[model samples]
Target: MEKFKNRWEITQNWQLIFPVIGVIALGYSSFKIANAIISKFGIATIVIVSILCFFLLLKFTLFLFKKLENKWILDQKWEMIRVFIVFAITGSSSMFIGRPIIKFVGITKENLNPIVYWFLFIIIGLIFYQILLVFFGWLFGQFQFFWNFEKKMLRRFGLGRFID
Candidate 1:
């Protein structure tokens, strides 16, 4: 317990919630993936697959954590989990948000060419992703980190003039 907390620089009890949430989220994600991949399997098989996926995901996440630790500046290591959670939420919400906007704009494969419809859908999703990323970052108390990230991304997209 002490080692886990110390590793993440968790000095306060409230900060412990992030790690717990991260585990639950990861477990749910693993189960979802396993179920989607083998819906016809028995319960035992699915559970086994889910458990396997959980470990695989854990290993992959730890690998990413270590790799990104050097690239990202942070006051505490636990904050990285929070940052990842915000990104997950923002990315999922962006697709839902874009779907409604696309329907509202009356853009559908049946009406428009499939390629054009998909192109517009992706464009709208990206726009919402940019907006939601910062919003979720602020909500999760990582505004500065994601705001700077947003700026760097925009610059790469050649939209630096709008921000500067």
Candidate 2:
């Protein structure tokens, strides 16, 4: 209980639950997608692929955590988990928001060429990602850091005029 309390101080107690749920949801989604694409490849292949995907996800999560470590308000190593959680939520939110807009605009792969559809999807998703990164950072108690980061990124993209 004491240990849990210490960790929760770095983030809201309920907030910690999100990362666990996010990781499980991501893993399940990946497994389903992989299964759909590789069902004919045999169970051994599926298992191996699933393992590889899990490791890749883990690596990416850690990489994100490491990259954002300096910007996070919490300095403890364990806080990296929280940072990863926030990043996952932000990224998922970006894609979720972008998909609806794309669908509304009737930009499906069936309508547009596959390459064009994906290109537009990524562009739209990236726009949402930039906006959501700061929003999620605020929600997770790192607003100032992300706001500065966003400003820097916008400047890099030649939108420095927008930032006062």
Candidate 3:
């Protein structure tokens, strides 16, 4: 426990939730991917594949952390996990929220051109993602990081005039 806390610079017990949730989310995602890929296999096979995928995903996530550490200004290493969790939640939520919105607006592949429908779906999702990113970041106590990130993204998209 001490080692883990020291590793992530966690001083408060409440701050431990981010790393724990990150691990559970990663494991659940790995298991779901393994099940989706190997649905025909037996339970034993699925477990093995899920374990393998979990390690692979963990390695990939760690690689990303190492790569992003320099680029991201964070108070502690644990905060990165919270930031990632916010991003994950915002992305999935944007698509989930956008689907009902598109349906409400009478924009579906069945009604609109397939290409146009998909384009609109993506655009709407992106818009919601932008809004939710800061919202979730604030909820997760990382508002400054994501707010700055949002401004940088807008700047890259040629919308710096609106940011000030």
Q: Each model's number of backbone clashes?
A: 0, 0, 0
Q: Per-candidate TM vs. native? A: 0.96, 0.64, 0.95
Q: Write the per-residue lDDT of candidate 3 for residues 1-164, one digit (tens) a residue.
A: 99999988999999988999999999999999999999898889999999999999999999999999989999899999998999899999999999999999999899989999999999999999999999999998899999999999999999999989
Clashes of 2: 0
Tens digits of per-residue lDDT, candidate 1, 24-101, equal 999999999999999898888999999999999999999999999999988999999999899889999999999988
> On TM-score, who's better, 2 or 3?
3
Q: Give candidate 1's whole-model lDDT.
A: 0.95
| Model 2 C-alpha lDDT per residue in residues 1-164, reported as the tens digit of each score | 55754754434556556557757866876687678879999988887787778778778766876786676566554555655666778898999999999999989988889999999999999999998999888887777767987898899989989897
Evaluated with TM-score, which candidate comes out highest? Answer: 1
Question: Which TM-score value belongs to model 1?
Answer: 0.96
Candidate with the greatest lDDT versus the true structure: 1
* Model 3: CA > 4 A from native: none
RMSD (Cα, Å) for all candidates, in order, is 0.9, 4.3, 1.1
TM-score of 2: 0.64
* 30 Cα displacement, candidate 1 (Å): 0.7
